[model samples]
Target: MVYHVLNGDALVSGFKATGLSGEIIVARECLIEGDLKGETLPEFLENRARFVEDEFNEARVHYYNNVVPEFEKLLNAEPGSEFNLWFGYDLFCRANMWFVLSLLSHLEGDKEVNVVYPSFRDKHDIWLEFGRATSEQLQEAFDNRINFAGRDFRLAEDLWTAYKQTDLGRLHDLSIFHSPCFPYLPEVCQAHIDRFPYKGKKGRPERVIEDILKKNGRDFKTVFREFSAREGIYGFGDDQVRKIYDKVMKERNP
Candidate 1:
């Protein structure tokens, strides 16, 4: 059976429009913004569940009902099943991809996993080009999925291990592998590292946002546009960027 593991619900319609006969499983949780510590799998889920509740102001029930089931799909898949992971090249998508690959690495099976990248791409704004792609274009991407060799999975495993351990240095070193299947991995890893608090005790993205706001005044629409144009690699939507803006201004004015 073919299982399509998507990055999020945003790509569901485009994927379903392809008329592909497969189970659509979405990775509902965001791993990029939470603590990555736990001795066991269940404990890890609980920690993430709590983090999601606090960070998103969501309830634990939502995590159990919405998030856990999707991961369960990955865990319970039958042996020899075909898995196609549809994730973007941004840090957010790459984090989830790393987790999925880490899980798949442990699963005992004849797992033939492939990464279905964006088919219709934009060189300038490549991170978001797939979001505006047509359904036919998405299908084209699926049809030309990139299969992983043994070494690719091993590389994914190492990268994920480093991420889980919060080993930024290891992640940077591992990113140098330059896997054929994941050309943007080095940039993604650096983007992840860049997310940590840096200059002026702010994340590089946050610093850029603050600078944009300061230059353009409090007009959020203009600030967001500048941010997107300047740091498209972050792949931050308005809502996410707005959260940062709200916090920065709160601290600045108050």
Candidate 2:
């Protein structure tokens, strides 16, 4: 599995292998461990959380040193995977990406800072290339820090409103369900979904997937295809997507 820290807060987690099922779990483990400002509660969870956090930080450095640089090179070349787009479109991805970018940007031109900088500079450059200015702009808008709840609230609300206006959001819900990791995926996706009202109903986890698919003219494959096409420069292959999907399923079911 590979993980990319977007700004300084969130991590965009992915893998290189096909049908590898552990990225999401790893991501969740990292989140629980990092505690992002020590927000995670329950005193007993702290020890386990610290262990996870340590592991996540180690993996992150390892990925930056070895895997991420290579992936960045691929993204710079032609026929790259749409991984960047996948992250750009997803709320979680954007939040994570932006936070990481912001942090690195602040650390810019400073060799003394003890932070891992992505091999690919201007990590948010792809956002500009794709015309998804909101997230890119938001990254600039916020102080180069994670502050998920603080800065992410406005961004999340905006994305939820926009997604609710389109058929694609529903479709995403279906793809989430087909995965073996539906349990975990739904928890994350639904947290965002429930924040808004769609068709006079507050979105529920149990029915979100079916509800999305049932909506007229909603096509998950097509949206994914378009997303893939736009993000071709990022070199996110089918294998990576399948890996993330499988991993989420296992974690959810397990």
Candidate 1: tens digits of C-alpha lDDT, residues 10-52 = 8888788888889999988677777788878789999998988
Best lDDT among the predictions, by candidate number: 1
Ten consecutive residues with minimal summed lDDT in candidate 2?
110-119
- lDDT by residue for model 2 (1-254), tens: 22222321133221221222222211222221123342222232344345443744544445445433433432243231111212332334433433333323322222111112121225544332223234334344222222232233333434333343443476354434332211133444444445346787643322333333344223546433443444333223354333333443454469
Provide TM-scores for the models. Answer: 0.93, 0.25
Give the poorly placed runs of model 2, Cα more than 4 Å off: 1-87, 108-201, 204-207, 210-254
lDDT score at residue 224, model 1, on the 0-100 scale: 88
Lowest lDDT block of 10, candidate 1: 120-129
For candidate 1, give the lDDT: 0.85
Error of 1 at 107 (Å): 1.2
What is the clash count of model 2? Answer: 18
TM-score: which candidate is best?
1
